[model samples]
Target chain A: MIKQLILIGLLGILFGVFFVSMQDIQELYNTFGKDYIAATGFADTGSRNLVTAILLDYRLFDSLFEAGILLIAVSGVIWISKHESQEKNAQFMLDKFKTPDLFVTFSRLVYPLMLAFGFYVIINGHVSPGGGFQGGAIIATAILILYYIDADKDTNIALIVTIEKILYIAILLVASLSLVSRGELFTNFFVIDASPDTKAIYLVLLNVMIGMKVALGLWTIFTAFLKEGR
Target chain B: MNPLLTFVVILIGFYGLSTSSNIIKSVFCVTIIESGVILLFLNLGNLDGGVIPIIGDALPVGGIADPLPQALMITTIVIGSTVTALALMLCIKVFHHYGTVEWAEILSRESGK
Candidate 1:
């Protein structure tokens, strides 16, 4: 009985804390009013979306670091797969497509549309909510569907290699351009105001490159797992 | 509904994390938990009547939703995706190494060694 009371008491206190926190947030909003944006100078960056400004400009170094992370992950996966390839082959069954013909045809019809949608999202990321990461996942979904449909066929290793090369080249180009335009090399150079058109072009190009890279990288990793798990 | 729903989601995620035996399931639970935190943050930062946090001559005089939290959430989402991917990869590695995904079996086998 004593333990039950203690539990109830704890729950009540937690509820009280939550209520107070919400009230505090509301109070803070009341206090700040419109002065918050005026003080931030976010609109001056030429990006209408405040979130985009922060992501592509304000904390660009962090974004570059994230790209580095993708590189490291891809390299690590490659290393691990190479080490375990021989072991994986003996146990793996590369041919396992037991689905109906109708399902395969449906997936084939949907795959191209999905890929196009992914590309659209990547291209329009600067002006919208969907960005490289979201689009890349969508693209990977398309590739995965293809892989499932054609399990017996030789995997499209060339597609993955091409995407990887393109991404590396694009990253290098962007990084170099940022370095040259601004003395602060690793800063978010894409936001620098040469022209609105130029910035938009660069943003779209970077998004597409990153999207392709992530999609291919994820596809490779998943295929490696499927091969090993079989 | 009230923002309390966010807390409920968090609790559900915690329950999932604590009870799940499969490594992959636990990783997904962690993603759910992270998403709950993101939702909570977004809710906390939202103003009752506000506009997007962008400065212009046409700006409103009323409250403006906090841009900082939105920015933080984007960063959090990216980090969360990477972490979840790495966790799944780790689970795959564990499965490859031990031939089983149950934490108990793996632990017992390691202990016996």
Candidate 2:
């Protein structure tokens, strides 16, 4: 009872602090801050989507480290869940799941479509609502569906890790290419000066690299969990 | 999307964090807090009659919703998920060692309290 009172008291204090600090959300947003991005972001990054422009171009360095964080997390999860030699042939929890026949059939039907949609999102990131991270997550979800269809199905984990690392390097190389092209780093050079064609290509290529890295990283993390104690 | 509502969601998460005995429940509470934060940001960045950040000829005359918060929160969401995954992995290790996921149970077993 004392613990519960303390918890409630702490929460009340925190809530009061947050409430007092918060401004009227309706009054806060004005033309000065967001207008600039919405108005000129397209001209600057040559991407129809302002959010994507901000993510991949203006804040490219942060996005790179974002992928790095994911890589580190995947590695940490795998390390912590590493199987002992004695458990090499142990039964997996994933194998014991009794998936219904309806799920299996539906998964098979939607598998190809989900994969295609993921690619579409990545490819059109500069033009539309979806981008590398979201698209990659969708692709990972698609791969996750595969587990439901065939619990015993396995992937070459090592190969996926290698591919993810390579994609990360490729993303770095692409982001830095601006340094050689126009003596700048992180910003897409084509977005700045090159014709529209090259701009789209640079943005799409980067999106694809980031997408693949994220997809494979997430899959690796899932695989590590499924393979735990085995 | 009221800021107060957003804060309430966070407060609920904190309440759960404080009271929940299960390690997995605590992890879920942390996730709730993250979601609350995300909602708060998106809410604060909202405009009254704003359109989507995507630009076109038919763009509304009022304004576009703030894209900065949305972009930044995407980073936050990814980081939050990674944090949750790492925490859950730790929880699994703890479960394996102590054969229980309750915080009080683990501590009592560990310190012989």
Maximum-TM-score candidate: 2
Q: After superposition, how far is residue B46 of candidate 2 from its true place, in Å?
A: 0.5
Task: Give the per-residue Cα lDDT of candidate 1 at A56.
Answer: 60
lDDT for A16 in candidate 1 is 70
lDDT of each: 0.67, 0.83
* Tens-digit lDDT track of model 1 for A63-94: 65676666567556555555523554422343
True C-alpha contacts between chains kept, each model in order? 0.18, 0.70
DockQ result, candidate 1: 0.35
Kindly report which residue stretches of model 1 are placed more than 4 angstroms away from their true locations once superposed: A1-16, A27-43, A78-97, A153-173, A187-193, B49-68, B71-79, B95-100
lDDT of 2 by residue, A36-138 (tens): 8877777677788888988998888888998899998888887887766635542366566678888789999999999999999999998899899989989
The C-alpha RMSD in Å for every predicted model, in order, reads: 4.5, 2.3
> Each candidate: how many clashes?
0, 0
Q: Which ten residues in a row have the lowest lDDT in candidate 2 chain B?
A: B55-64
